[model samples]
Target chain A: MLKKPRNGNSAQHKYPHVGRTVSLASLSAHLGLSKASISRVLNGAPAARSIPQVTQDRILAAAQALNYRPNLLARSLRRGQSMTVGVLVPELSEGYATLVLAGLEETLSAAGYAMMLVTHHHQEAKLTDLHRIVMERAVDGIVAVDTSLPVIHSTPTVTISCPDPHDGVTNILLDHDRAAELALSHLYALGHRQIAIIKGQPFSSDTDIRWRSIQIAATRLGLSLHPKLVVQMKENLATDEPGFLAAQRLLATGIAFTAIFAFNDVSAIGAIRALQAARRQVPEHVSVVGFDDVTLAAYHRPALTTVRQPLRHMGALAAQSLLHSFTSGGNHEASHSVVVEPLFVLRNSTAQSPALSLQC
Target chain B: MLKKPRNGNSAQHKYPHVGRTVSLASLSAHLGLSKASISRVLNGAPAARSIPQVTQDRILAAAQALNYRPNLLARSLRRGQSMTVGVLVPELSEGYATLVLAGLEETLSAAGYAMMLVTHHHQEAKLTDLHRIVMERAVDGIVAVDTSLPVIHSTPTVTISCPDPHDGVTNILLDHDRAAELALSHLYALGHRQIAIIKGQPFSSDTDIRWRSIQIAATRLGLSLHPKLVVQMKENLATDEPGFLAAQRLLATGIAFTAIFAFNDVSAIGAIRALQAARRQVPEHVSVVGFDDVTLAAYHRPALTTVRQPLRHMGALAAQSLLHSFTSGGNHEASHSVVVEPLFVLRNSTAQSPALSLQC
Candidate 1:
């Protein structure tokens, strides 16, 4: 229990509730200046440059003395810009969406835009309602993350890892082919021939593309993926429970494999737990590779060997693109895709296959 | 790369740019009614109930036909309520803050409140500026998470895990005493006497209280924590790097310890890794206990035996309390602390001490 206030800063007392009572008209009357000139000077409008410096200074001095905090709602109404961006995510969790949100918040805040966050919980009806709510709130733009946007709207929009490309929405995506190649090549070089795979939940936007890219990469490397060794996540959960269950199913198949390529870092951690529970030591009997080297990947026991997606960078890119479209006069028609490459991070979780070592 | 739009439903076309062109005056003229009557009816104002249901239905039908969308800025200015809450966090990461934010977002969204999120990044100047910005934006309430709040203003405020207690601000905190009791008792019952401990970063709000509670619990249990066996985390990182380093420092002290109580789950995982590197097999040679059973804790390699701090519930409590103050006419002077209990999760990482078994 807290006993006393830790920070007793007096700075907040400078701006009190008096600002709510002071109006622009009162300040204009006190300074004997026209309301238009006072408004222009206070708003820093382009036309304010022509106003005499002495008059502007006097108005500003009086406004400050009166603690005249301009109501943002009124100012936004006058300028026709709310200076807010709506961000849509499936849900807020530790992994992908949170990292991207951190990046988006930094960029948007630097540009003086507040983010109005809404989670759809991966429900179609909820997504529709959220879109309507944000639109009704009159956000200047929207950034949809890992959610299929409904349709083209008048507002400028940007999507991060969204598979659906709307007519006017810019898409920021990871190069799944490069990601697959990096993860698969490392495993292949380690001589992991019999590999088990954990696929992402069906609702995830990256599941299909990432799986397809992995299959392509495997075929190119002259490796075949056995149907029995592949397990798909059935539930949309924030925890690693689904991955743990999937790994158990893979083990139940009574098949032998040298390694597992999990859908993400959390799942990889789960798969490793399952292997340990089954008395299969990682990197000694099985080599596990994970994707999305999230914050936990590096610190995970056995330090996950994974493919890194710059999640925060992707979020920043979405924010920047949406802000850019606004500054460029809403040129939504120039919609295009920006692809970012992935990096392969080799850590302790993976190594030379046990079978290969025995053979050698 | 995305090639085409996925959902081509024509729902969005119903509300187009025509809303920008149509005005209440135009609708008033079209209906041959006064602008005041039309506005009242359209806004569903209390006075509109006096009007006939037929007339209200007619007004609504016409507004829908005209695709009239009210400008929220002007509406908010008229009502003097923005229906928005400002959420302040140190930074957005996967573990503590993200889980709390997810809960806050869910409860606030259900109550029709938009969240304007800002991260202070643990800077005094930035926190002050963010306070001013959110106030200027006229947010209905404020929720500060794991950050020391400034002096209270007229705004209704609630804090999640913030150490500071200000007038008119409610604090939602974890019951650290019970948490310490649960963890220490569990460790003591396992016959662990020589235990190493990892302290949280000094900047964390819960660090001091959690440490004090642990010390009290240790004294009550007749277990003495050796000075050389304890190490404190110095960095405010989201990863387990700090924990790993702390554990290595403990190891370097050459003190014989059979178990470690880490500051959090990530650090516990980090300590486990460090122990493994030093050839100490968990539960076989050393046991590890963690706090804040995060999403990855159950799936951790050793399945972290941790203290569960119901983070999402804490966040929901903050939102619900803040909203309650608003509906209750801002009775913030009744600001009180809400203490939530922690759960002790028994998992794979902990076991009876090896020294005890050796003696037996």
Candidate 2:
């Protein structure tokens, strides 16, 4: 498909890969110096030979003018580091994971570290394979994005959004309990009593924590936390399919509820769809809230009210922690745990209880 | 956060990073064979060093039992290949880019190639920096996701959703013309004569192509193509903010259009919000159509009517093209451009024109 651009300006835009193929011999020839002298000067070798300082500066300027970038493999080999960080994600198709990865990449790149992306596809076998490959081969450090695995590498490791840890590992965790409190407290303040909750996938690392936190908070507020009002989704919470199915099930039970607290924005959207299908108007017949204010949360119809977990910020912090541990050569300085707070973003999704509206 | 597992089964699950560190000396001692013979056998040296077949099998079995993985850098150094691929993206936060990247990673990993992820952040300086670093590093092949650049290295390269290539580069285009036709034709078939299009960022690689296709198709169909009805969105089409602002401007223009053809799903969603805010009922007052039926498109309110691109498939094919070129040692075998077709998915967002409703 590649042909010379018909436009003249495009031809002048130098392609990314056409690097300057400058070698020691070329540098030596460009300047009146021997290959050995040019190499010694460029590499900053000790004064084994008395090369004039003026000649050295000239050689350096020529090399710079030629856009000379040192071979990374040779440099890494000499330095005993790959200058790369391995990033492990459970899946790449997820918006949440990808957004976090973008953050990690930004920080890692600025710090002169490349990222090796590895996805486990939520399969134990694939996770094992990725772990073996990443641990046995490259990457100076590792960052596991939203994964639950304990650190087992001799190299420094950091985790994002995951709560568990192992020896010599730093963890960046989201305050799940706080997120629940923010959502439930908001609903409670709005005079909601029979508030239904949509539970996340049962086996997820955060599901129990979030569920227990909500349960505890609801109890403290004297609100009913019953299994009949709790909807269970499938194993994959990222997709809306499980959310759709679970909401449909909740509606099928003929349960009466004035408000719904969905596990995430996707689930909230799904619940809204179900409510619409049943000819129930959102925030008029029932109110809905969600967690994880993803990019789509703000754009969705009714503009989902959700608890936002600074995904990008968490990613950046995790990358910084890994770099610090790897550079410091000890996990002690970087092993400290970081707990990031979640914020409640109010939108049009939730409103006053419909029973109160009817009484008024 | 690190603590002992509450369940006994958790203790049995072996950690992924704790690799069995079996050395050459241990293998030799266990099998009662010399280190030189074992090394030659394990390295698969030719018949010049004849080791017994039984001994070779025994050694291989032991290595497998011990779960030994060879050092990738040392092996690559010996073989003069890095066994890794560099993947470049404009940004990682967008669903489109990350979905394609997931496909690329899947194929590359299956073929024993680790992926080095580089994000240019849509900045010339970052692109230059990434180009310099990747070119100087150890990557056998390259894949640019949603980027347009000429091939600059002997290493094979494949681009996804990008047109206009240089020699020896294979482009995986999305058939933007077809996508536009699919969207425009669908709206036209629905009895909509006055159509407004939300144009993507003017400087994007596909913006012109998509715009031209829409213009040509609209003219061919004898449809009114008015500039007053058109909306110009911000450069970042993946985010909803630009779409929101652009749609607001179009609404402010007071253009009497029955339908809208947005640049992408994000833009379509933003348009929907604007239309709603203006007291316009979708499909009843105005119909909205979008492109690149992202995952959220299906979950969005009114279930966005849009064109779907096979993003993951494109990623896999691009990776395969690069691997084929690199492994075959000739760009000829892999320098074939592939254009994937887009599918039109009908949903609630679009319906018969309001003029038709009045007539009926």
Candidate 3:
């Protein structure tokens, strides 16, 4: 779905899960960093902590960068250790959330900290509804994904999938800006001059960064930043609307772009469907590229060339981060962030420029 | 995952997110009977209550049916109220879980019941680790799906998607037995006598019932059942014991069965992959059918024909049952068992038995 144009409260956006109980040791191991450092960072007790300043700085940075509020109840519970952590995700069944959850559970369980999971429906995003879980000291710590963050007084939390930064929570995110740069660089290196971008969702951190970076990269490569060729996508809207909206406008008022870069795999799928609907043969007529190499990308008729987010790694990392928060005596002084790089996967969706009649 | 061939409680299953709530209202709802009646049934306050015998019976039945157990701690705190309900599921985040949870959450939220979710991944069925989620007054009631049940003090609780009478919990389920009967009966009526049953995960409830029903139905129809005709599948087994094992076994023996009935769409997928690997045309050399009309079922190359388990309705009903238990005020009354019917979806996977084979 496209990112909503409006910004709700971070808490409202990142709903909390109320039915879990988390402990410091559980959260610490979930973090996947050194336990000693996790303890010193969370406790702020200022004992003879012996980690390097840089490492400690990264931990602290990670904790602060996440979009979640700290879980304070976890601090008290950890002092009286329970050896458990909590995980709350947007939709656990999604490939990304499931993978991360599996990673977190595996890491924490290995560290003797069990995981209590809370999966909320789309409606539970209300700030109060989401907050109720953590306020009751259900879990020692939390790991949140895609779903909104919680208003936590004491529980240490982490959020992933987006590049948003937080104060006390750790964030594991994708560098969309750099990813777009690579996409642009790859296309330019392939001798493509005039390119069009099918912007994914209107207001997503990822789409926003990619769009901005794509324009910047095009300008640096001496290519024109043509707005006529830019196609903006609306979230949850029918896939064809965006493709038709872009295609109709492009066809009526001819553009010189030779290649199109779409926001995500879904949008690219829409583009292909629309192109076929318009009797436009893919690659033979116009080369296209997409982001997020989802499962069905390879199954498409022409197959899709896309930017691959390290979803499996991200999934596992999210789990590891949460476990780390639970294990270190529930102390969260170490703030850190884990940003994974994206891969440019080559498939049949993209190709060399093709001849076309540009009436305009 | 294989269902462990074991009886109740002593198994090593781990259910997380349950068994830890100190709230009131949530407990009363799992009974699905009524709050006032639940209070009377649970508190043994019949002396002051003037309700009829039927109401009392219903209340008691609901409590007994759901295995309603009130949390003593919350009751003591709130003068007899535990606002939390514990929900344990085999694992959440799968496509089925997504729909089921949507139903469960929608109902639970409307009834004003706060829920604690426990999703676990057990290597196998022995649910001995259930002690972590049970053995406490944290929650007043419980609801489980595809997980092992705990033997203990009955608290209004329910279980779904399993074969056992689930001890004392309300066992709301889809009749896999009847579903299999319907599938096989339809195929037989279509003049398919030389049929093969492609079972999944060895001894799965759906598969086992299908396996037996095939034999029983074939007997009733006066069709001889062959030993090589009933094939069990273990497609991604860890043991290098013929990976994608079932399909290979079916093709290796070179025993020809005109019609094939797969246990589920997943195994059917494995079968299709197997058929492709073996260069056998589906519905030509072997007419195929599967169970569980999963989304991908309708999209397969030959478009698999399978049994549809009203997944959305089943999920909704399961959620509604759990919500009913939580809201009607923990009345330990009459137990209710709901059996939903399955439908046969006709597609290309099955056809009339070949005339050449029919004469033989």
For all candidates, state DockQ relative to the true structure. 0.36, 0.30, 0.06
Considering summed lDDT, which 10 consecutive residues are worst modelled in model 2 chain B? B1-10
Which numbered prediction scores highest in DockQ against the true structure?
A: 1
- What does candidate 3's lDDT look like per residue over A103-173, in tens digits? 56456655655554455533345434544543343445666665545354455677775445567677887
- Report the C-alpha lDDT of model 2 over A189-286, residue by residue, as the tens digit: 98888888888775455677888899988988888875788987875645676777877888888878888999888888888888888888888888
- The deviation in Å at residue A194 for candidate 2 is 3.2
* CAPRI rating of model 1: acceptable
Best by lDDT: 1
Residue-level error in angstroms, candidate 1, position B11: 27
State the lDDT at A89 in candidate 3: 55
**Model 3 clashes, total count:** 118
Off by over 4 Å in 1: A1-26, A29-34, A50-57, A192-197, A226-231, A245-260, A269-287, A299-302, A348-360, B1-35, B193-197, B224-231, B248-259, B273-287, B353-360
lDDT of 3 at A323: 65
What TM-score, computed on C-alpha atoms, does each candidate reach? 0.87, 0.85, 0.66
Could you tell which candidate, 1 or 2, scores higher by lDDT?
1
